[model samples]
Target chain A: MSFDVDIEVRRGDRTISCAFKSPRGITVLFGPSGAGKTSVLEALAGIVKPERGHIAVAGRTLFDADQGIDLAPEKRGCGYVFQDSRLFPHRSVRANLLYGWRLQPAERRLIAPELAIGFLGIGHLLDRMPRSLSGGEAQRVAIGRALLSGPQFILMDEPLASLDASRRAEILTLIERIRDELGLPIAYVSHERGEVDRLADTIVPIGLPD
Target chain B: MILSEVEWQIVALSLKVSAVAIFGALPISFVLAWVLARKHFAGKVLLDALVHLPLVVPPVVTGWLLLIVFGNNGPAGRWLEQTFGLQFMFRWTGAALAAAIMALPLMVRAMRLSIEAVDRKLEIAARTLGAGPWRTFFEITLPLAFPGVLAGMVLGFARSIGEFGATITFVSNIPGETRTLPLAIYAALQMPGNEADATRLAVVSVVLSLLALIVSETLARRSMRERGGHVL
Candidate 1:
């Protein structure tokens, strides 16, 4: 299995529990709004700490409460594409895409920047500020940025949730390409039935399955 | 030509004192502001209150405290002088130090608000993309909070320009060395025939404060515009 995760995270008064193991390709955390699906992605990215249990990805133990092992977010080698496209508003698209790429050591750089930029098709939009881009363009740039981060795995939190039908289809195709071509393990968060049906290699229901 | 050389010297010294004070206080204020804005630890309340002591207590009390700590024979004063040949007693640098301390609370408050206003989610995103804490702060948090930082500088500079009680008590009003605009104004007022001189210095002080605010606001707006038009 590429991912073996059984974690309980506390959010306010409510506690969210999730357990899943997935083989390579996309593992979809399917659920409705406020189901704590996004929280799962954050935990995988090491941005949110799980209260208990363990997180093992790609033969590496990221977190194990019993073993007293917890890694920092930056050391986890994750490319997290946030739902809002969280591009640095102060930087150009080119700089945002290269922010992590430049930080990775030459030997650690797994994906070439040119290839990721070509795959995401954000070449023409490179010089533009994030605020000026359309939602779809921003997301594509965000995806490109994540891909070029030289990460071991990618966690996407509902990247298509805010897109139009056409844009959604486009990003869906992009996600499929990333899974099949890049061969990178993906933990994708989504509440869409059609999306899960179309893209999930392994479905981990976050809440009651609809 | 219109003002005497001594009056001009006072204006220049006032500017120099405020400039040094703002520059000296900025990094410390930023670090304190970031911690206050982001961290939760034991004694945080005490730290916050201590930081604002200059703002709440009477200026004369603050001045007396500075004198006690930074006086020639005080522990800190002796050690600094022994270690680095640094002297703060009865000098312009001592006046600058007093102004900086008096300005620190306002500077920290403005910067803390700005840092708090930064989207924490973006910082998280930056971390997930392989940035360490320092890298993320410099690359993302600082740039986004630049406008607030500028505003804080102006607020601190304006306060430093008007610093009187603390500067007078800590450094003493030595002409050409420690006397600033407000001190010059007071000196002129002490003499019966020098109302015109005091008025000129007071007018200059007002103009300087106004200029600092206008320049700070313009720079802040420009920075915000450059970062995509979300003016603070």
Candidate 2:
């Protein structure tokens, strides 16, 4: 599914103006710390209300200022994985993965818990609590939690930022396996060119003057 | 026989009063905690102060305020009497109301801490997971705040069990009507040769407070353990 986003957002004193309408694939948003790449993902997911412009995902109007429409993040069906995994500390790994499925209106949750557990290679860790997992393990679980919801497009905000270099290398392969093998559309945020070059089907470079 | 009867009476009365107080204030505490922890409206500090008024204000003053709002011929009191054949002044219900008011601050404080501690990212994750605002609260925010909610309940229960000043002012120490444990203890102490009864009741109060505190601490520790393990 193709998506379109044309918006301008202000982060502190800096203003970011993005105008892009790309065909659906793995679109990597490359930028430095202050380049407002995460801001773009947030805008798409209906987290940060934009100052101006509209976002249309798969022909559906997710945000339109002139039309007085701004869908809530949940309703937009855009999954987001934070830099820090942000797993529910109160829940076990199984519970965290099943949280989204349980919230689904019975019929909407197409993926079963066993399927999700297998896909994330976390079947062995299902009964384990989030606290017991390694950083890479937690991110893998976080990804499983997000994918279980069966979102239209996934937004990953520097998912590997918290891991060690070796861990990053390992998780990068996992992310690619999820994207390429699963055939899921992704909007990945990263400052590392190597990660972008390896996984990205289309690059939307940010941070530099444009 | 008389001492055992009085002990049972105090136990039953204290339990009843605390239950009613907790039931009355829990929903209000949830809403107020969310507003205080999440919302950024104008005069938020004032709203927070108003919710926590009971903590700073004397229980006697809280009792007096309850009397003013729920006494005979008072607006809420008159409306309730007319609409539901209810009477708060000089009644058990009034003692409950007083206890609830007294305990509200503790409950709100506990709930606010829990709500504030919820990861904003998790809530955002739930939203993207196709859970709406209300769904997100029940499925994500509330569960994540479970440890806090339980702690709040214990705080409210402890506060309510010991409530005396407000109970005395609003409902008085009517035996078997509104004479909760604290009230019973106070009446026992005032009478000639009832020191033993007062002491027994005081010990019971201590036991209950200790139990509540222990449970609260356990829950707090479990929550910390869960979150701490997740951290890098």
Candidate 3:
């Protein structure tokens, strides 16, 4: 029900290191741009391997340098919603959502596609292509796609950065509803403090490395 | 319309040989293109250069190399002749093999460029959604790069149809067997008072090549549009 991370990552000249435990709630990593906030989530999601340290979600060790254990992103079972919503342009909305769900083991499938579609209010968009969707609609689909993958925890990296103010507000409300209704742990990365205040159950401040 | 019955037979044989060559080379070309596009390993440069050698070398040289490696006296040719009873020298199959070898570089180049153009981010996204490497490639990379694949296939087909030097050098100009359109055209030009037959074959070649180009262009544009990409 919690994620524990202690890792150090080096990107060229800069080094990023942090250790924190996120309980069963929305934990927001608030920082300025270029503070490596997204990198932290990427490390947790097994997209970027850490230079050193360990990551565990729900007591499962995803990465441990001492043990020489580093699970692939697919095996880590952590859902990631990128800022750009990286939906497959060649696939319809339903196909994109089912891309992960179809691969999940029957016993491990915690969230059904229907439930995800219902939760995200994207049922009507099932047949449409990702390119035709609005920014907000695409992001919602991205969120639903993540949820349907049966992830142990969700990592969202500035998921609403590309949306307008109105769409942003609408998505924020949807996120709140998801957190309250589904009770899924989320590690949200954002530079905006207002968003952290509204959604974060625990806030981890990130800043430029000394 | 000016083509005689024998000339039409040559045309049909040419089409059949080139079609076989294209389809035969496609799967191998795709695998090679993917390796060239996505993988980095020792000897990669050497492998790439080898794959592209037919493009820069003289077609006669390529044909000579094929003859050296796949001729009746060669190990592979001997083994195939003994084990499989398949001979490539002076055969229609030899013509197809020559055409495929000559056209492979174009197919690989087109497929590699297309594969490279696919967004890596989409692949990473697929991985996060629990798709294994094979699944990601088939479901995401292949579909996204399909337009380029089609373009490559057309280019290969066009090249196979026009293959001359390698085919003639490897298979020799055996009428009704190894003599394709280009060889037939050459044969007509060599005989006295057969200039009209050669001109007819030339026109047919030009029209077929033009049709292939148009079809490739249309397919490429349609693929781009289907993926919501702006047509350039």
Q: Evaluated with lDDT, which candidate comes out highest? A: 1
The DockQ figures for the candidates are 0.77, 0.63, 0.77
Q: Distance (Å) between predicted and true CA of A177, model 2?
A: 3.1
* lDDT of each candidate versus the true structure: 0.90, 0.83, 0.89
- iRMSD (Å) of candidate 2? 2.5
What is the CA-based DockQ of model 3? 0.77
Residues B1-232, candidate 2, lDDT per residue (tens digit)?
2449757977898898889989989999988988999999999999999988998898889888888889988899999999999999988888888889888888888888888877788887778877888888887788778778788989999999999998999999898889998888889889899888888888888988999889888867876786541110
- Which clashing pairs does model 3 show? none
B27-87, model 1: which lDDT tens digit per residue? Answer: 9999999999999999999999999999989999988888889899988888888999988
After superposition, which runs of candidate 2 have C-alpha atoms over 4 Å from their true positions?
A102-116, A208-210, B222-232
Model 1: CAPRI class:
medium
Candidate number that wins on lDDT, 1 or 3: 1
Q: How far is B39's C-alpha from truth in model 1 (Å)?
A: 1.6
**Per-residue lDDT tens digits of candidate 2, residues A62-114?**
99988999999878877678888878777789888877767667565546778
